[model samples]
Target chain A: MSSKHIVVIPGDGIGAEITAEALRVSQSAAKKCGFSFTHESKQAGGAAIDAYGVPLPEDTIEACRKADGVLLGAVGGPKWDNVAPELRAEKAILGLRKSLGLYANLRPIKVFPALAAQSPLKPEIVSEVDILIVRELNGGIYYGARQEAVIVNEVEQAWDREGYSRPEIERILRLACRSAIGRKGKVTSVDKANVLATSRLWRKVANEVAADFTQVEINHMYVDNCAMQLVLNPGSFDVLVTGNLFGDILSDEAAVLSGSIGLLPSASLGDGTGLYEPIHGSAPDIAGLGLANPLGTILSAAMMFRYSLGSEQVAAMIEAAVDQVLADGYRTPDIYQQGLTKVSTEEMGQQVINRLK
Target chain B: MSSKHIVVIPGDGIGAEITAEALRVSQSAAKKCGFSFTHESKQAGGAAIDAYGVPLPEDTIEACRKADGVLLGAVGGPKWDNVAPELRAEKAILGLRKSLGLYANLRPIKVFPALAAQSPLKPEIVSEVDILIVRELNGGIYYGARQEAVIVNEVEQAWDREGYSRPEIERILRLACRSAIGRKGKVTSVDKANVLATSRLWRKVANEVAADFTQVEINHMYVDNCAMQLVLNPGSFDVLVTGNLFGDILSDEAAVLSGSIGLLPSASLGDGTGLYEPIHGSAPDIAGLGLANPLGTILSAAMMFRYSLGSEQVAAMIEAAVDQVLADGYRTPDIYQQGLTKVSTEEMGQQVINRLK
Candidate 1:
């Protein structure tokens, strides 16, 4: 079988420290499963700016286009804060998503049985929680047409238009349904139809799309109730789909649900290509100290194998290895406990690799 | 001294049960504090619909406008569900708010020390939590200019504008600051300034407003961050002010923070009149069962005294009495404990009245 091609862009700060370990762990998982892997490193963000005077050089975009999947570590730090605001370190991901035509962002929130005690919710509430959130990323308020401050009726006023055409809402709902197909087969489309016109339109589209997926049970809830449920009854939700603004808020709230934001992995997918990465940001102060956590990135590799590569067995192997290591009380500095064994980034990666069998 | 005029609208269902106890509790507090009270009962919701053929009758609005403050119980039930959706039981409050021009909606979330065990969050996290959320109810997305669904380029689309004129934002921020003045002297103005033009305008206006209120410390946070902070650090916030859309979502999230949604109260104030009520809805299932909780409505009466009737001492007296009753292990059915003494709605009201001295 031909080796799967993956693009590695360890953009800045601790990006380099963690991506190396993630790559090692990916290779170990591939070896244990009798599969071959091929990958290439590319310059982006601050590193690309130092070499080519731009955060996202054309060559980097072209390289990602040629690969089957893209794996990114954290991006942005104080050192590049003075760059032109448009060319700042964070734009690399934004530019990549637009250039790759990625629209749906998948963030899975699962309270690991071994680490359920880390969450703020009572143990019983977090015990049975596994949620997949499909957020429509390319449209809505963030990408809406806007006008700067203008005098209206002798008062300073500014507004941004929020709109979602049928195509945008349909694709996202379809993606959410697809995500729920192999799980509990439940999808909850969240909106503010009681207030916003955009939400009413979104809800109409959702109901229309839901009719085609008869096997999946669908529920529509107001965004406010959904936010409360995330805290009050998080175990009740399966797959949640929403517009960009609500998604941004609810996803962050869900990230906080785990109490392990630094160890979470996310995937962005379009109709054609997929991109996987860790959810944390670059830690400039400890960039070279080998103190950065690599589990998020290693898990991102697992996501790549399951989503972009045709290997569910390899993905499951990598994920099980991570679970095995955590069960042994092997902890990184970010998630260290008083009695647990603390390991550096490389050591933690090695522990998982050793458990891959 | 002249007696304060109070209009009582026992709207429907549990609304009648709770408001009767609330009115009784108010009379007890007034008697203990040597203040005279003059009150009138008016019909609204389904009651008004049966008598005057409208959800919000003109006589009810006229009475509320002439009074010093309004004490309302819950509204809406299945009885009026078949009414024209626009003329349903729930529209009474909406009609009242628009007619009364009540722009500032106040919801206080304070986890009572005696009942902190009711919260889903660990007791340690809920121990020091107290928050006042002031939502601008008249403007923002709910009342903005909107275009209904229209096909453009063969795809259906709809949009709602989100705009805040200077005066609208200023008055709400001023109200929030005033709310903080008597409490912790700190305010947090939540917005989404980084992405939305309306939020940027809100942030700029918030900063300008902060300069005028030198005695109180004000901080600005993005809406997404505020949502997470509500769960992660509820105790750190004193007062939160935001536009209607964000507020509608965040205030509900804050309400969940206390784990006693059934025991929460709210107030809506304009320049001329004030309206007070509990945060929960009329549970038709428990309409006249004597099982409804009355503390929330009774507490709303306390807010009425402090905010509209100019009786902070009496308000404090009423609040402390309720707290004492709870501490003594007196529980209503909604909040009953395994071994605590259970009481009917009016019995609990009498318990609070007995503690008023």
Candidate 2:
């Protein structure tokens, strides 16, 4: 058995309850797959602010850097709303990503067959949706230099730069191409090539990178069209990749198509240790009440196993168990339908554990 | 009766057919409301390329500049696909917008009750969607300074600047607020203030401008959240205002929510002549077959009455007639239903004309 280590950050609100369930489920699934891993709980977000006066402590960053992967149960809440800009709870994730050198943000938007009715789209339109959005995290307009509102030529204006380097686009595209392998083998590289210079360069680099992956077929789409297509024909996509700003918009748009955001997980990856988390924010309203959903966190753990722990078997086992659990009609309060069995946060985790093969 | 002179550009493919129907409908509507308008036929797009060797001829620009307003049919077809970048058929619209100083692009996305089933979204969710998107057109990243791919610090990179002036943001927000006055009296200013400098400035200016419209209620939304909400609860929005890039995207996304792009109309307005057109492209395959839908063009004409021609009564009459015609089960090929009366493009135009009171 290969032994690996991980850091867990149960940041705030329902983070504690959900991360506990996810940790237990991860242990059970790893045990079933004959895999062994150790995890240490760390402080970050509001919890870290309360403990160390900073949202992201140096100690936590050091631990995450040394670990194989990190599992975060979200950050930020109204409790930390008044914090200084640099010390805000949400800065923890940004700091962690920067420190860990995490570049690509992978968001898998899949509509579970059992939950298809929950979608805002017609059931037929969303039932077959299984899209993987590979968003380049550290580049593009989000991280580019910006100027605040200032007087220029007698007019007050603010500006931001949207830039992409060949290496940045190449790496993210390579990851997207690799991600498409063993899946649908289709990658849609989205940009605004006709209008933006960075997008034009991105398209060129995308073509160059995709050439190295023979099995992966790639096509380019404008960001605006892609936004419409995600709602119109989401199933037509396999791996959708774009820069930070477009990805931030499209992934959130795609996430809502599932209609159950609490069940979606996200993974941030780079050359070093990856970070995993639920797409939803910390629900301070349901903190410690066991009313929150733990599946997103558990799915994050599954992604951790696949991307960082080198245990695709364990990841598959966990994911299949989750699918079976939902198929069996066990639901948390967040996803509860009238005729289904409504389970609590812990009960949902145990249900998945019992079904793990 | 006051008389107004307008220029009509029947650009390419179905442009001639649709514009002719729209022109006839507009004249009849105006006549019913005791108003009169004179229109001159002008060539642009591929037609201009054929006639004057330029997609946007100096004559067309001068004519449009002097006219009260401009009504355009769809532009571009495969025949002009290989034209030089600057001479492309699509350049005609861009050139006209620039030359005429049309800076605001308004796309009204309203789901016709009779065609609600055609939406990819559930009928209940889409049945009440009526949104007007006010997009800033003349500025933002689309028109920003850019650097093509070049070696920077030994790595090839490309960049584009996204800038917004107080005047630019203020005018668009003012337009949105004014647009909301008669309808819901609500405006949702969408931006990415949490990320970009331009968005922060946009939000600030939106607040300042909206303060001037005391009757119009306004709120701010992150662009990503707005994208999700447009699908999850589209009926929640009244007038959504945003910058150039965000508008181009959200408008198209909202257009698909109607599921009948052929029936959607758009208006670009500024200090001078407003440009009105349908959101759909010219369908060359069905160009001369009378199979194209003309409701979008007619609706665009209706907007011309409201915004440029300064006859709200004529605009309302044209719009109500359109609504009643659709309710009476008259369908064009693009929005046809099995049980409804499928009419030719010309027949559909005639139906609206008959319904005009």
Candidate 3:
């Protein structure tokens, strides 16, 4: 079998520290499982903005495009807050996405049975909750034609264009349905169709896509109701598909339901290679403290294995290894309980690797 | 004193039945307080759409405008799902808001001690939760200038103008801050200023307005993080103020944490009279079954007294009556526990009135 090449972009602050351990863990897992892996490191985000005069260097984007899979640590820090919007750390991620045409953002929120009590929701209600949010990333108000006038002459009017093409909506729905078919055979398309015309098109195209997936059950819910249901009856959802803005809000809430963003991983993909990353941002405050949680980054590697490399067995083994480590009481400071010992990022990585062995 | 005139718009489905009981309860309270209430009935929503060509009849709007306050008994039903968007039942509620210029939509979510165990959140987490959400309604994407393609085969691009004038943002923030000072003495302004230019203007104006109210501590949170924090640690919040769309989602989620939307009430106010209503939609499915919860509507009447008519004492009396009735172990089907006695909508309303006497 050909060796899989992975591009690692540990963008800023804690990102740099965490990505090292994530790579170490991945390397150890591949060795234990008898698979060949090759990894290379690149710089992006705030650090890139400082060094190369651009947050997303052309070479970095080219490297990501050519790699079989990409693993990214978190990005952005207050140190770079003064940077212009396009040149900021977050813009690098957005630039990579647009340049690579990465439209589908997949986020899985699951309540691990062992840690269910940590949920804000009652244990009985949240124990079995597992939801996959498929967000369309390339379109919506985020990338709309936005104009803002800050001058103190007349009243300032800021307008954001929210438009979606039939093809964009159709492709996203099709991708979501296929993902649903692979899991629980159910999908809930969320939109504000009751108000917005873009949502009307979204609902229409989603219905047409649903007709193609005869075996999968498709449902529609207004975005507001879906947000409520996510809180009150989280177990009822399987796969939720929505646009960029709603997805941003819903996914963040869903991430916290698991009790820690450190345990959540995400993937961004479209027609080409997938980019995997943890959902948490870089913590410049605790960068050198060695206290950053590395599990999210590790799990992102697991997603990269499955989605980019198409190695289901390898991915499952990586997941099982992490689960076993957690089940054995390895706790990072963020998720550390009353009696468990708090472990550093490198130690956590070592513990997971030991479990894999 | 002139008898306060309340225009009642019991729009459709269970609206009429529930509003009748809520009115009876309010009248009983008014009699005991040595005040009088005069109720004027009007047609609106889907029923109005069927009887008259318009969802909000001009006569109904005029009647509500002339009254001291308007009491809406929920709107929308599946019977009007196929109707044109403008003629839909929700249009009536929206029309009322725009016609009345009801810019501030205030929804208070509290997990009453009596209903603590009914919450989906852990009892320990939500036992003392009380939060107020002030949503800007008259402006933003909901009522913004929306341009849609009139015909197909054109480069169909739609744009929604989300404009909030300096004055509009300041007035709402000032009102919200004052309410916060009256209760928790803290205010959190939620926005997406990190992305949306309109939100930056909101942030700037809200900060400026907050300076005038030094007694109230003011802070800001991004909308997505705010949504997550609401679920993770709801008790940490006091009064949250946000734009129209974000407020709609967060308030709905907050409603869910109270366990049943059946017991929550809301108020929409601006330049003219305030509009009081329950947080629930007209449930056509359970209509005429006597299962609809009337507490929300009754509580809405209390909000009408406090916000519109400035009758704080009357509002407190209504709230006290509700507390006493719930303390007596009476439960609606939605909040029914194994051992509690289940009461119908009218029966529950009567119990509240009797307890007040």
Candidate 4:
């Protein structure tokens, strides 16, 4: 049996609770697939900032670097609200993404058949909604320069710089196109090319690289229209590629369209090891109350299996288990109903594991 | 009876077709309301570009400036695909916005109970979907500079700049706040304040302005999370105030949630004269086919009456006519299905006009 080492980061709030659930589910799937997995727990985010005075400890990064894969529960909470925004819990996640050179943030929006009613959109419109939004994670305006609040003639002066380099745009675009080719053989490169010059470059590069994927149908939609189309007709899209700023907004919109943010998993990958996490943030209000949904975290574990550990069968088994659990009417509070039984984080994890058996 | 000069610039593609419908409906509504509106036809957009080699002609701008109100059908088409992007037909519309100082772009997303079935979201989720998205039209990353593809050592280089000033942020925020005060009295300011300095300033200024609206509940949401929330729980939002970039993307999304982009209208107001236009672009593909949906353009006419002419009653009459028409089960091809009464552009216009009587 092949053995893979995975780093588990239970950052803050519901992080610790969901991290345990994901690990338990992963262990069961790994054993069934004839693989042995070793888990190393580490402190990062708000928890690390509290314990080590640094959001991301040096030792934690080193351990993650040496690991075959990483599974994160969630990060940030009001507990870190008093902390300087830069040294806040989110900084650790951003730092990991930057240091790991995790250029592509792949968020898959899938409307599982069982939870389709939870979507705010018409059931017919979102029933089988499946879209992969490849967002450029580490670049664009997120890391751009700052001018905080400037006082000119007693009035505040505020400015922020938004700039992007060629290499940054190209790499994200190439990865998005390659991912698109692997799926529906179609790619829609979105940008505000008419007004933004950076978007024009994005348009040009996307077209240039699209030529490389002759088998894939390459299309372009303005970022504004793309947002509208996602609500109007989501099924028309398969793979979406865009700049970092746009990806951040569009992917979140796509996530909610999938019915529950708690049901989606995301993978941020680059030059080093992959970091798998749920698209949803840690809900401090619901943390440790057993009310937090762990399905997103478990799904992240499945992604780690398929992408990092090279265990497609194990990943599929884990996915089937999740579907079966939902099909059997087990619901988390976030998606709970009166008649349908609501299960806690631990119970949901156990239910999936039992179904896997 | 007071007579208002209304500039009707039916730019290109189905713009001309739709504007003709708007003229008939507006003239009929004006007559019924005992008001007189002199409609002046002018050329703009791709049609203007083709005939006069200029998207925004001096005469056209002058007509809009002199008129009491301006009603645009739609602009832009692929016919000018090879043309310099700036000189394209869309620029005339954008240029009109800049010249007119149209800063606040108000897009209302209202799901009609009659056509709710056309929405992809479950009818229950979309039934009462009514939101007003106040987009800052003039500033943000939209006007940012860009250095197109550059070659250095056989490698390409590209850079785009996104910059915003304090006053620009303050003015737009104030406009958004004032607009919110009239509606459901809730303002959700969306920005990237945590990451970008411009957002920090935007947040600071918006907070200060929000303090003035004592009755309105003001909340802040990041642009990404705001987009997701828009889909996840549509009812939670009433009026959303966002920057130019976020507004451009979100307004389109909100429009589609209502079932048809064909039923949307937008108004852009700045320091000078306001411009009203349909959110749907000129569909040259359906140009002479008479298949264009004119409701958006007609609704734009209603917005013109309310904002520029300051006649909310006339606007309400037009809106009521529209609502009743939909209630009567009249559907255009874009929204029509079997068993529904389908109407053409002219028939739809006449139907609304007849209802006004």
Candidate 5:
């Protein structure tokens, strides 16, 4: 038996409602697998602003530091739109990522068989697709040298640099290789290597990293062609590793393939404690209505088990429970279909817990 | 009647055959509309390399500068893949765009009612979609400062700068507004404002440019969200404008929306002279055969009439005739369905010319 300590930050809006169900499901899974789980809830984003007048509180970071892993629901809303730039809810995410050194973000995209009918693509094109995009989260153009709104000779110009050190490329590529160790053992490094110097460097370092894992097959694709292939034939890709700029766009493009963005989970990992979260944002419009989908947060907890707690069997059990529930036609308001059993956020959580093997 | 002198560079492979059909259609349209048409053929790409050992010759640039506009068929093939990088087919495009000052790249994506079934997207989502992407061609990371493969401390690094001058942003936004003026008068400026300094500056300058054209409805979208929306709801957009790097990705993503990529045409415009070309590459395997699709080049000719020759009526006539031919079930090898009447490249061109109003 194993014991795990986790920090849960349900930041604003529907985050709390959906997060509650994830926690409940996690507890049930822990009991079924003979593992011990402990968690403490914390406030950030708008909730922190309302109470402590700051987007990220020191205590929240402190708790995360002391924990083995962190699970965040969602953050930001219309209420924090006009807040001072420094106190904005979105900053909480940037702050946490920076503070925790979360350099690699893992976004796994899969198309459930039962849910294939809901996809925008023809069923045959998207019926079987599983791709994990490993993005270098905390570096690249986003953190590079930048000049915004500078006037020279009364003319305004803007510039941003895209740079990647050897270590940054190595770390993310290594994480992707580790992910490949669990999957089909194929990695496609996407970049515009022929053009951008950063992408060229990215490709070189990726190849160097690939040399370390001889069992894993690695190839390269340009960012633009990767975008096209995602729609043309999504199943061909296994693991896609890229720098921040290209990953930000490609990951989002891959997310929409399933038409189940509300039910997808993501994990951000570093050399330290990792963070897991749903890919969807905080839907403040439906905060207290119980209409939010809990499956994403629930799946995030599953990812937490596999990546953070090192329990692959437990994670598979949780995911199979979800697949079973979805196959059985029980859905929340977000993924509701005609004749399917409709459940509230809490009810969906309970259903998954009940189905846990 | 105004006389338009243009240069036609039928680069390599199937380019010569496709260019012949487009020119024949252009001449028929000119005769029907009482406008004078004249063109000079020039060597470029593989053709120029075979003839003069250079991809883009100085004489060709001089001829293009003397013409009112330029029309180029597809360029590049595996035949030139091993040639010196500087003597490659791609340089011909770059050289022409730079020499002609073609800064605005216009890519129009439309889902033909007849071909909606061919889209990867379900018919309801992709049908009736018409979007125009106005991309600034001459600026941003593609033209930025670049450092490739610098080794330090026994590690390799690379960097690229994304810089946007005020005038570059203003010119592209102004062109987008002008495009909007001819369409629905709505423009969605895409950028990564939250992360990249260039995007933030792009947004700021775009807003300043928007104020001048008060009647045009302009909005902003991040590059990632724009990628999602391209698949989720392509019909909701009209005109999308952005910098070179973002445009390169987004435009290609948008290109695949219609699933009839072989039939799409693109235009690059500037103050001096505009260039029109088929978005498809030269297919050497199908070169000199009667099987290649010529509609993209024909439509490119139509764009030349409107954007370069200042003959919107001729352009509309050409487009409607192509629509008529397609609706009548005439198909080329690229777009042929089981029951449609199959036609060769020249026959399809003739059918459209016969249907011209």
Candidate 6:
């Protein structure tokens, strides 16, 4: 049997409780698939700040770099809200991404059939929304050089640069095309080509990268139109790929379509070790209350199995069990409907375990 | 009587038909309000390309500059799709904005109660969505300096600059605060302050500018969160102000929530002349047919009356008649429901004219 080593960072707030359940599920899924994995706990975010005087301790980074993959719970809370800008709790995740060289952030917005009624969109529209947004993480304006407010021509001004290289665009687009091949074989490369020079270059490179994957059909859409389409006709998209800034905006917009944001999972990937986490923030208000949902974290672990552990079967098994658990009418308090069986975080994980075959 | 001089540009495709109806509605509304305005027709867009070898002729620019306000129908069609980049029909609008120094673009996303059912969102969510987006049109990445693809460090790269000065931020924020005074007296300034330097400057300047308006309440939101909030709770926003790029995306996203893009109107304003138009595009396919909707163009004219033509009463009168027309179950082809009385482009304009009191 092939064995994998993983680092689990239960960062802050409800992180400890939710991540414990995710670990149990991962173990059970791995056992059922006749594979094995070893994971060790590491502290980051507010927890690390309290333990090591830094949001991202060198010890944690070393462990993550050597591990096959990392599973993180949400980070940051009011407790660390006033920390120095460099020592901010949220910096842990950013630091980990930079150290690990994670370049792409993948957000899969899937509305389960049982939870379709919870969507803000009309039922028919929400029912068919299964989009995977591939966001280039390491480049673009978010990480580009910037100027602080300074006097120029007797007026205070500030600026930021948005740039992309052919290599950067090619890699992300290639990943998007590869991702589409496993799904509906459609990729929508979104940019502001009509207005921005960077977007024009991105579009050109996207076309070239997509050509390598003949099975995948690729199209380009302006960011503005894509924003509207995500709400109006979300079912039409399979994979959406864009630069960091556009991705940051569109992914959040797409996540809310399902209405229950607590149930969405995300994965950040690069050439080496990948990072998996729920797209939601640390719900400190509900920390340790047994009311927080564990599905997103559990799903993140599933993504870890498929993308990093090289266990597609275990991934599919875990996902199928999650689908069955929801179909069996088990819900966490956050997603609880009046007539359904409302389960605690531990109970929801166990419910998925019970449904696993 | 205070007589105002206005110029009307009936550009390509459905532009001529819609503008004629809007012009007639303007005349009737002005007559009823006891205000007088003199108007002249000007050519632009593809029409001007054919007549004067340019999308925006010098004659049209001079006429628009001399007028108190300008009303334009939609521009661009397939006929001008292959033109040189600079001579494209769309360039007419850009040129006009530059020549006239229009720095603010106002897009009011008001969902008529009768048409709430048309929204993709649950009726309860979208029904209360009446947001006015005040976009800074002259600056940000769209107008910033850029680099086309070039070999940097032996890799082809492209970049665009996003810069904002204190004066630009102050002017737009002041406009937003003033605009909010007439409505809900609340302004949500959107930016990406946590990540970008420009956004930080914008936030700093926004607070300083908003202090001048005691009647207005202002709050700040990160652009990513704002994008999600637009879908999750659009009704919570009164007047949303932001830089150019973010505004371009959000305004288009907000427009589709009403489900009838054809019924949306827009206005671009500056220190001197202002331009008004519908937010929808010219439907070249349905050009000569009576299927086009004229409410958007008529509403644009009404906006002109309020903002530039100096007649708020006429604006209100036109708006009330529009609401009454919709309430009376009249619908154009694009927004027609099964049980509503379907009216032609011309008849719809007539309906609003008849209801004006």
Among these predictions, the greatest DockQ belongs to 6
- Model 3, residue A241: displacement in angstroms? 1.7
lDDT at A31, model 2: 91
Model 4, A205-269: lDDT tens digits are 78887888777788999998898888877888988988788898898788887778898999998
- Native-contact fraction for each model? 0.77, 0.87, 0.62, 0.80, 0.84, 0.91
> Model 6 scores what on Cα lDDT?
0.94
Q: Which scores better on DockQ, 1 or 2?
A: 2
Model 2 steric clash pairs: none
For residues A158-218, could you state the per-residue lDDT of candidate 2 as single tens digits? 9999999999999999999999998999999999999999999999999999999999999
Q: What is the RMSD, in Å, between candidate 1 and the native fold over all Cα?
A: 1.3
lDDT of each: 0.89, 0.94, 0.86, 0.84, 0.91, 0.94
Model 1 segments more than 4 A misplaced: none
Tens-digit per-residue lDDT, B1-357, candidate 6? 989999999998899989999999999989998999999999999999999999999999999999999999989999999999999999999999999999999999999999899999889999889899999999999989999989978999999999999999999998899899889999999999999999999999999999999999999999999999999999999999999999999999999999899989999999999999999988999998998999999999999998998899999999899999999999989999898999998999999999999
Tens-digit lDDT string for candidate 2 (B240-345): 9999999888888898999899899999999999999999998899999999999999999999999999999999999999999999999988788788899999
Against the hidden true structure, what lDDT does model 5 obtain?
Answer: 0.91
* Shift of residue A71 alpha carbon in model 3, Å: 1.2
Error of 2 at B187 (Å): 1.1
Candidate 2: where is the Cα deviation over 4 Å? none
Give per-model CA RMSD: 1.3, 0.9, 2.7, 2.8, 1.2, 0.9
Give lDDT tens digits, candidate 1, residues A1-357. 657888999999999988898899988888878888799999888888888888999998999988898999988888889999888888899999999999999898888887878887777878888899899999998888877778987889888888888899999999998788988999999999987889999998898888899888888999999999999999999999999999999998888788787778899999666888998888888898888889899888888898888788888998899889989998888888889899998899999999997
Off by over 4 Å in 6: none
TM-score of 3: 0.93
Worst 10 residues of 2 chain A by lDDT: A283-292
Worst 10 residues of 4 chain B by lDDT: B155-164
Deviating ranges (above 4 Å) for candidate 4: A151-157, A208-217, A338-341, B49-51, B76-87, B151-155, B214-216, B288-290
Q: What's the C-alpha lDDT at position B244 in model 6?
A: 99
**lDDT tens readout by residue for model 3, B1-357:** 547888999989889988888898888888778777788899999889889978999999999888889988978888888987778888898889888888999998988888988888888889878999999887788778776633357644444666677877888999899888779889999998888888888998899999999889899999999989888889988989998888888888788988878889999998888899998889999998989999999999989988877677778899999988888899889888988889998899889988884
Candidates 1 and 6, the one with greater lDDT: 6
